[model samples]
Target: MRQRLIGGIGRLLAGLRSPPHAVLAHAVFPADEPLSTLPCVALDTETTGLNVLRDRIVSIGALRLSGGSRDNTPPLDYLVHPGIRIPARSSAIHGISDTDVAYAPSFALVAPSLLGYWQRRVLVGHNIAFDLAILRHEAERIRLPFHPPAAALDIGLLYAGLKPRVATITLEAIAADFGVTVDGRHTALGDAETAARIWSHLLPALSRLGVATLGTARSLMAKQRDLLHGQAGAGWAIGDLLPPHRGPQHEGAPHG
Candidate 1:
């Protein structure tokens, strides 16, 4: 009891010290809410490079899904001025070039709308920690308080948790596993849509794995974090993307 109280106090203090615009304004969904009925923003980012510390987001693609429904709206796609030269190798992979974003809006110009869209929605991505790290740095550039969704989910972590023997967890590999075709390969919107579909297919299987609620899903991710630790390309743990006050809450241990 004393330990729990001290931990609660520590979380409270951390929340108090966070920037005024901490992403989580309130718990939009309860910890016990069914993962199947959870609203989520499936998102992806095309960036200048893999190094989160120095790289920048060249484009962001996202599609929002309402609780218990499939995506019905067009994706929110943006090509932002990354404030850095797009490396040739990076452009070769993501197909975004300096000329393409020459007239694009700066990250500062798009941060408000992007942040607002992410509010009240669980952010879902493949290897989400890297994307979150890049976004955090971008927000920090503008001195904006940046915190990812308290209930964020990583498909890579979930897959690793469920299929520990799978050697790769790339979006394309997982998409193929689920029979989801590669539409916009390497494009932000295309990958986001594919992830959302793959997530939908994984929901039932994850439920069978004893991951039915947000908390259980988080617990599973926490269990699988070590497997995905260095996969983010800079040693960023999956949990590093979690909010300061919102450590992974384990309602119950996930079954194999």
Candidate 2:
């Protein structure tokens, strides 16, 4: 009893010391509520490069969804001056050169707006960890405490769950499977909007599979990732199953 009390106190103190914004960002989506009834933001980012430790976010795109209705609120689309040269390789993918963002606001100036858009909502993304990692790195650079949404839904992971035996899980592959056509494939806003549409299509299917809530969906994704890792460890070359695409080169490349 005493040890539990001490642990609880420690957690309380840590929470107290955390930034108010961070505190407010905590979210728990009840299992009883249908996913379509929950509020969420689909987000995406274009970066100078794939290295979260070294690269910077060049742009962000996000749109809000709630109660089965996508708010007509214009998506938040911001171009940021990354304060570094945009590599030619990455520029070819997202088409944002240094000159395009030279006059745009720096991350520090735009952080608050981004946070405002993200606060108190679940975040959805294609390859969400990359975007979140980039955001966290940017906040650290500016000495601001960054708190990501407590819950996130990754469409890529969900797609992986749907096709566990498949080796590759690119956004284009999943989008094609669901018949979602995104005009500007590599652009931030375009990808985010595509992800939103994918989520709409996925929700009902997920519901049929007993993933009717955010928490269940997250759990299902974890299981799917574990299965993929196990398959890879058994010398299954999953990448051989699909063609290549240009996106962030990370642990799960070509997916987001």
Candidate 3:
């Protein structure tokens, strides 16, 4: 599995004219590596709007969780100047005004560090496809090759998969269901901390569903492809997860 991961990333790297420092050769992990042993980074992005084609990321929040540690690494929060006027309605939702980001760095300036920090860790978040999409756009705008983490988990999708009958799967709803406190509701870092907590709470449930490893989690999330596509309609910015297949000769792994 490790070799397969290496080969897969190698192929991707070979295609890149110049893979950035973010594309570390050692970032890829074995498919069957246990989830509990793998580090995870909970991420969130506050954007200008819902349209991936036009909107830009205004802020990014990410925190590293070592071996699924409840106490996560110090969080990284960046406010970005999106180079366009921030809509008043959008500002009303996230509380990030033009003045707030007036002195902030542009996405191009932040991309290297942000992508580097995100490399080699499983990315977890609530309805994360949208966040991933926004980041992909930012990377493309800067002509940076966005090589996302080997795996990404969506708490909303995971919850929906486990409790298919539930109607509400909002970030607030999922955090509330898991008794996670919502301190930073709209801010990137605050939401990321909440997501990390929700992921910690959801781990046991995931295990019970037979999703014990990164590969199995990939399988589980793949089942939520429809939901993922709906979240990131452009399709290009969604699902940074490694495919379930180990090789062409083998069938795709069993879904969680």
Off by over 4 Å in 2: 1-26, 226-256
Of models 1 and 2, which has the larger lDDT? 1
lDDT of 1 by residue, 42-118 (tens): 88999988777788998888888764356665456777778889999999999888988876778876666666666
Whole-model alpha-carbon lDDT for candidate 3? 0.73
Residues 1-256 of candidate 3: C-alpha lDDT, one tens digit per residue = 2342334234333434335654564367777888887888899989898777799988888888865674434466778789999999999999998987876778876766666676778788886766887788778888888777767777777888788788888888888888889987998888998888888888888899888787777777667655655554444344365364421221232122
Query: TM-scores, in order shown?
Result: 0.81, 0.78, 0.82
In angstroms, give how far residue 199 of model 3 lies from its true place. 0.5
Model 2 scores a C-alpha lDDT of: 0.70
> Which residue pairs does candidate 2 place in steric collision?
167-238
Give lDDT tens digits, candidate 2, residues 1-256: 2342344334334434547565455665564656877788888999988776788988777888883357876577777789989999999999888877866767876676667666777788787766876788899999987766646667777777766777767778778888989777888878998888888888888888888876677666666555435433433222221112311122432322
CA RMSD (A), model 2: 12.3
Reference-based lDDT, residue 85, model 3: 95
Higher-TM-score candidate of 1 and 2: 1
Each candidate structure's count of clashing pairs: 0, 1, 0
- The full ranking of all candidates by lDDT, starting with the best, is 1, 3, 2
